[model samples]
Target: MPPGITTLAADAPTLSAANTGFMLICSALVMLMTPALAFFYGGMVRVKSTLNMLMMSFISLGIVTILWVLYGFSLTFGTDAGSVIGWSQDFLGLSGIGVNELWDGTTIPVYVFAVFQLMFAVLTPALISGALADRVKFTSWALFITLWVTVVYFPVAHWVWGSGGWLAELGVIDFAGGTAVHINAGAAALGVIVVIGKRVGFKKDPMRPHSLPLVMLGAALLWFGWFGFNAGSWLGNDDGVGAVMFVNTQVATAAAMLAWLGYEKLRHGSFTTLGAASGAVAGLVAITPAGGAVSPLGAIAVGAVAGVVCAMAVGLKYKLGYDDSLDVVGVHLVGGVIGSLLVGFFATGGVQSDAKGLFYGGGLDQLGKQAVGVFAVLAYSLVVSAVLALLVDRTLGMRVDEDDEISGIDQVEHAETAYDFSGAGGGAAPRATASAPGTPAAPTNKKVDA
Candidate 1:
């Protein structure tokens, strides 16, 4: 071969088919999480608002996908803009990227990276929906998602994960999305619920979950998908970092589940299914940021701490009376903080980067950096999300009418009910009699089982 041809071949980037396949699968797994969240949040709401709850999460998959393709990806992953946001004309509409272009230093195609990140963008806003369940108008909710992702999620994601992002430069150790996804969504949930006010009855109502089975299923799916969410964030498993992350994710989640059940058994005297499901999710959230940085043992600590902290935090809504309908603030916000901060203590100085946590002899320096990343995302998301919620509320009317809310958001918003009780209900069918059928079937006063 000619010298020029040989040099060209040497300089050209090599694509890893294995890594590409892995990331693509990971992207699909992350995408599955949005619908999984739909199920999780759906099962937590009253029967009257079940479909509405599901739709709130499912809508994000549609809205965020379009935005990400257009400019969301650019605003997030493009060239650095003053350490706050990203901007690159080549990334606008994702039009200028070549088919084989890799993401900075990664082996997978940039498109794969874009789609993978897009899934994260999709799921974050869906998380906030749990807090707003059973109250907001569907159209208003959809609009809020559009505005929230644009104003809040994109910028925060950039700050944490984008190239030259402030937190990334400050040495924050978010391997996945503890700060960007969970805390951001959790804080945003608090902001919106504070603005939107409580569900109709507030603390007076029972508000028990309509279906524990659905919640369990959703939690199970989240646990499965999180392997991709946490492990795949390493981009590839070639160096064993991703494999270690995968292992840490599992260890932490198991520890968290057991810890949460233990807390419930001690505090409430029973290991309820809801508690089990919630505990598992708390574990998943706690390990998301810490998994890549900590050992399996450290992950256990992170998971256990989050499980107990979140279990207790869920009750704060009652004490403070803000009405976070589904405990997004408790699990995501608290768990995210637990994972992010613990990295300052549990980090092994062997994975992701050389940064060591306090326990590893790195001292308070890394802890301080983690603190900045945590509070920065928290404060920004809280203030801005509240403002946006207020904007949407004033103009478009965030809540449904009082009567509509009392009746059911599913019927009012979606024009359908989650369960078709019509055929089996009180007035659905005439009572059948064992006596003479022709005798009007009237004398029998037995109630129908509808």
Candidate 2:
């Protein structure tokens, strides 16, 4: 080695190793969102299905995690031909993905990117399960998720985020899967709700959540993990990663929280904790797409509007009779659209790398592009998700038998209860069945702290 040559940078091995470590950590952070999601969905349901609801997120951790490593990543991020889907050039195995490989000139192991993106792929569909809770068969759900991921999720992920996809080619700027994750999942939830129909006692019964604090706990965890989810989209420790994502996340979330609470007080005459938690999530969803492309103030504007709009949207389901159990359509889908479109008008200097927003004197070209991108994604997701739901219904069947649904799926499906206070009762009090034709019993007063 010549003295002036500086050892030629160790053949890219050192840099690749460092970036791989950072990505691996980011993957772990994203994985935390599943359990966080468990609490979020779990707390929204009645007590009978608390454990069952939480298990939905947990099952994705088991199922999607393994599947992604096998062929999911290949189908998604593999080399593309014409941007429809990736070729099987790396199929059935992660062949040719080595430490020296580079994605966009960064010296990171391609496998690291594969795994981190896999975490996102795993959690996206799980977010929709909340909308069809307490009714559908678990077996049918597992089948639906499997097919949905393969057909709807993988192809759309490729179109939006993978290399050379049409959306990417069209200059659509989705910093962290606003269309791929949220809009796709939200739309899918609507499709499933249509197929499965409503819960037995949906509108007539109170159906209030058994635990509010649990919901708040889940929201907090999601808030914590989202920092990694949004910022980590940079795919490396880049110059703007910290500044752009950090302030965008905080400011938007804060504004949404305030907006939601304010609207609730005005409309409902009371500010419920549930509203606060939901508002925070609404803000988070709105900020996701624009996090890396909008100024801090722009993020706040986007989030505030999202919080108000989504809060109102929650009522639309009731008025329309769709039975979106957990408001996935209201929050994620609506919020996603708001964020994806607003960024085109709010993007500023250095955020978009050769693009500016309407406020910054960039004109309506960017906003038009953003609208085109949003509509394309929304239409594609709706058609694909509808097909997936129908397939699940026709083949294995999508919903449970009436008796099973009436009996509460926790015992019939998973063979477990979310709570067992009978042991403490000294065999004195009789255990209540979940579907006793009355309101489901709340769990024992013993509460888990948020």
User: Best candidate, lDDT-wise?
Assistant: 1
Measured with C-alpha atoms, the lDDT of residue 220 in candidate 1 is 94
CA lDDT, every prediction?
0.92, 0.83
RMSD of each: 5.0, 9.1
TM-score of each: 0.93, 0.90
Query: In candidate 1, which residue pairs clash?
Result: none
What's the lDDT for candidate 1?
A: 0.92
Please write out the lDDT profile of model 1 over residues 1-450, one tens digit for every residue.
346655455666578999999999999999999999999989999999999999999889999999998999999998999998999899888999999998877789999999999999999999999999889999998999999999899989999999999999888889999999999999999999889999889999899999999999999999999989988999987899999999999999898999999999999999999999999999999999999889999999999999999999999999988999999999999999999999999999998889899999999998999999999999999999999999999999999999999999899998999999667756655556576755664564667696
Error of 1 at 431 (Å): 14
For candidate 2, write residues 1-450 as lDDT tens digits: 446765345454345565567677778888888899889989999887787788877888778877777788888887887897876655446675655666655656677777788889888988998998888767778878888888888888898888888888887878888899999889888877877789887789877888999999999998888887888788777576545886798889989989999999999899999999999999999998888888888988998999999999999988999999899999999999999998788888577466787888889877887888788878877777777778878988877777877777788778898888877857555565666567667667656699
lDDT of 1 at 120: 98
Give the number of the best model, judged by TM-score. 1
Candidate 2: residue pairs that collide? none
